[model samples]
Target: MKITKLQPTVVAVPYRSEEVWAFGRRRGQISVLLEVSTDEGLVGIAEAAAYPSVDIVLAVLDSIEPLVLGADPFEIERLIRRIDLVGTWHHVRATNPAIAAVEMACWDIVGKACGQPLVNLFGGRFRDEVECFYYVARADPDEVAAEGRRAAEHGFRTCYLKVGAGDPRTDLDRLAALRDGAGEHIGIRVDANEAWAPGTAVQLIKEMQRYGLELVEQPTSGRNLAELAYVRSRVDTPILANESSWTRYDQLSVIRAGAADVLSVDNQMDGGLLNLKRSAGLCEAAGLPVVKHSLGELGVALAAAVHVIASTPNFRYANQAYGANLADDVTLGYGGGIESYSDGCVAVPTEPGIGVQLDADRVERYAELYRAEGAAFAFHDDQPRGEQAPALPKR
Candidate 1:
């Protein structure tokens, strides 16, 4: 069916509490959502990783809307390539905000058309439901230790904690207690958010080696791929490439350089399903692991990730998207695990597409807001070529 319309929605949610990761703190959440309607009367929904520039996502939808207006919705990859070929330097960063949104929605349409869940289309299910894990967002040592016990009691097999802030001694004390609390029942994973240096990462990894920790994500600066390799060679903890958000090429560089043992799959970063599959395939063949990364997605993106994690066989880590169960009422698809964590894994969704339908009321309410403001309210650098549309015709 030909694409009939492409609409973008931006929603802002106030945080219950501030989350302090390696990159400062965030108090609010914003998402770029796309709704694409096909001539055959099918509507697909997708989300992009556009927390940095929600408006840019609106602009992207506006520019690409025309490109897809008369095109077949089934040709997702071709449309993406066209965007890139016609895109400017900034367009890669700018337009890609909506790429994952449309790609995922198209996948939803394809799944609905085939009467199968998206994962089933990939390769069928390997596991029933994926096991899950939990983490205390930004807990200090004592706090994390307490939280770790709660997570263990709740039935999570693993607990992830934020590291790479403050003194190394403090982080060590927190990890030590968390390990003690978890004992042998739960795995402990630390995310430094690229907060550590080469020497410090090596030293800390050596110390934590005794705890049976699962992996360390972005221990050293992610800016320099070589530094990651340097630390990887010196440390025992497996490294994950969380910062490789741009494209498959970026992750490929990390893998070829021996900088990472796992790839954190962020579909929005790579633009959508096509890139996600490319990265997943590369990671699978390279003997590297693929892990899912979440960008405060509400329902759609998380559901899409679940299908992806389920279909793939080379997954070494559980999904970070499992954090959705804790994000207040930001969504309606709860029931993951508040007491007993994700059964210690994520499972395949048997439903079509992402399997989680959007709350129509919520979509309508948000869409009204979209119509009024539109993304063209603010301006940013646009992509090259005829990649983008003129800015709202100067109001």
Candidate 2:
């Protein structure tokens, strides 16, 4: 069917609990949802990442509407290339997320038309359920350790903790506490968010080995491939590269340098599901296991990830599906609204076209939240001095 319209809207949803990271504290997430409607009355849905800002995502989506409005939803790659061509080279970095969301909607439409799940389009299903990890945003050692225990109580096998928030001692104490609290059975992985120097990462990681870290992700700046390689060589724990790579060229550089032992892949980062599959294929060919990244996404994005990871053969690490941490969700009727976590894993969506239907009432409610409170909302770096640091909440 021919494309009919591209609709974009903002929604603000509260977090189930407050989270603190190196950046700051926040209690909710804001995301832009895009719906692509076809001539035959089918609508495809997707959500874009709005981390640093949501305005950027909206502007990109609005600017690219012309490129997507009249195209065939099934000719996904052609539509993507057209959007890229019109927007120019720099546009890829700036607007690929918007394009990625639109592409996902197209895939949803395609899946519905074919009467198949998105997993089938991603090279068939590899497993019925995909494993996930509980995320504890950067916090004090005791708080993080407590969350780790809760993760195990909730049946998670792995706990993902944010690191590099403060001094070396911060991470050391946090890791030690998490290991003790989570017990010996739970696996712990830490993400530094490119906050450390190679030297610092090396020294700290060497010490963290005692706690049995599953991996240390993106310890150094993503651009410093040589440094990543050096850290990987010096450390016994596997190094996972997240911010360092996205496109094929970036992957090529990382592969050539032997930068990291594993690569973290995200649908939005790679542009769309097809690109994600291609990126995973590259990692698979290189014999590196792939891990999924989370940006505190909601159900739409989380469902998309689950379908992709479930179909991927080398997705060894637990997929980062942090939507479960959200206090409420806007979509429903897709395996408990994509927050169906139990025994450390979530079942893949079996229904056609990503298998999620929007809860109209919730959407309107959150959209109202966006309209009324969007301007007042700002991320950690955006807040002024005096109001910058908020106390982390205790469970």
Candidate 3:
């Protein structure tokens, strides 16, 4: 079927918990959604990772529409290539979140046309359900510990805490409390979000070893593979490369440098599902485990990630998509949808074409919120708040 229409809508939804990032903190997220419809009456839906620039991403959707308007939806590679050729520079870095979104819609259409689940297109499922971790978003150590215990009580096998955003000593203490609450059974993974220097990361990660860290992620900046390698050498914990390895080429560079113990990639950063698969393939060839990084996605993107992760044999780290933790989602009808966190894993969507149906009403509700309030109004991560302020003591 020939592709017919491309629709873009921006939505702002509330977060279930306070989210702390290296750059900011927030209680909700603003995301862009795309609906790709074909002449045969089939529509594929997807979400793009657009933070801080919903309007820019909306404009990007308009610009890239011509490249795939009348093309074959099933010709995923050709369509992506044509879109890239039209404006190669636009696809660089996380700026291509829209490109990835459109590509995902194309895949959904192809899967629906073939009457198969999207994972089957990627090489079929490797596991029945995709395992994930509970990501603690609060800045308080007490809250962090409580969340860790709650996650374990809910059956999660791992807990992820964002570190390096504030005081190093306090972050360390928070991690220690998380370990204590989670006990020895739950795996603890910390993401520094490239907020630390090599020496600082080495010192911090070394101290964190006492609590039994399963992994430490992107302690230094993404550009410093050598520094990441240095941190990796000095610490006993496995180092996961997130910001440093966005694409397969980046993965190759980090792998060659012996910079990381694991690779973390996301569809938004790497371009699309195929590129994410290629990134995982590179890690597999190098005898390294590949991890999926969530870009605060809603159902569409999270479902796509589950499909890719299920089909990827090298994927071993806990899958995450904070949308699952969102108080409400703009979509519905997927087997488990986005709020399906249970038994420590998410059941893969079994329906055709991303296996999720989008709700036009809910989409409009959030879209109105986006229009009236503006994207920035929905962003609360710009500054420290509540327990995040006054910088608490360590130990």
Count clashes in each candidate, considering only residues at least 3 apart in sequence or on different chains: 14, 1, 1
Model 3 / residue 219 / CA error / Å: 0.4
Task: Residues 85-150, candidate 3: write the lDDT tens digits.
Answer: 666643453447888898899899889888999999999989888888788884688888888888
TM-score (C-alpha) between model 2 and the true structure = 0.93
In terms of lDDT, which candidate is stronger, 1 or 3?
3
Cα distance off (Å), candidate 1, residue 172: 1.8
- Compared with the true structure, model 1 gives a TM-score of 0.84
Residue-level lDDT of model 1, residues 1-395, one tens digit each, is: 88888876666443444555654555434566677888899888777756457666677677767666877767877877776776552354433657678778888888887778988877776556665557565656676677777777666777777776556776778788888777686888888877776778888889877888798888876678888899889887788888743467777788778888887877877777666767789888888878777666655676776677677777656667534234332345532235323555544557777676666676566555445553532223334658655321111
Model 3, global lDDT: 0.80
Q: What TM-scores do the predictions have?
A: 0.84, 0.93, 0.92
lDDT of 2 by residue, 270-328 (tens): 67888788888899999999888766677888788788888889999887776556778
Question: Cα RMSD to native, each candidate?
Answer: 7.9, 3.7, 3.6
- Candidate 3 collision pairs: 25-381
Q: Which residue pairs in candidate 2 collide?
A: 16-327
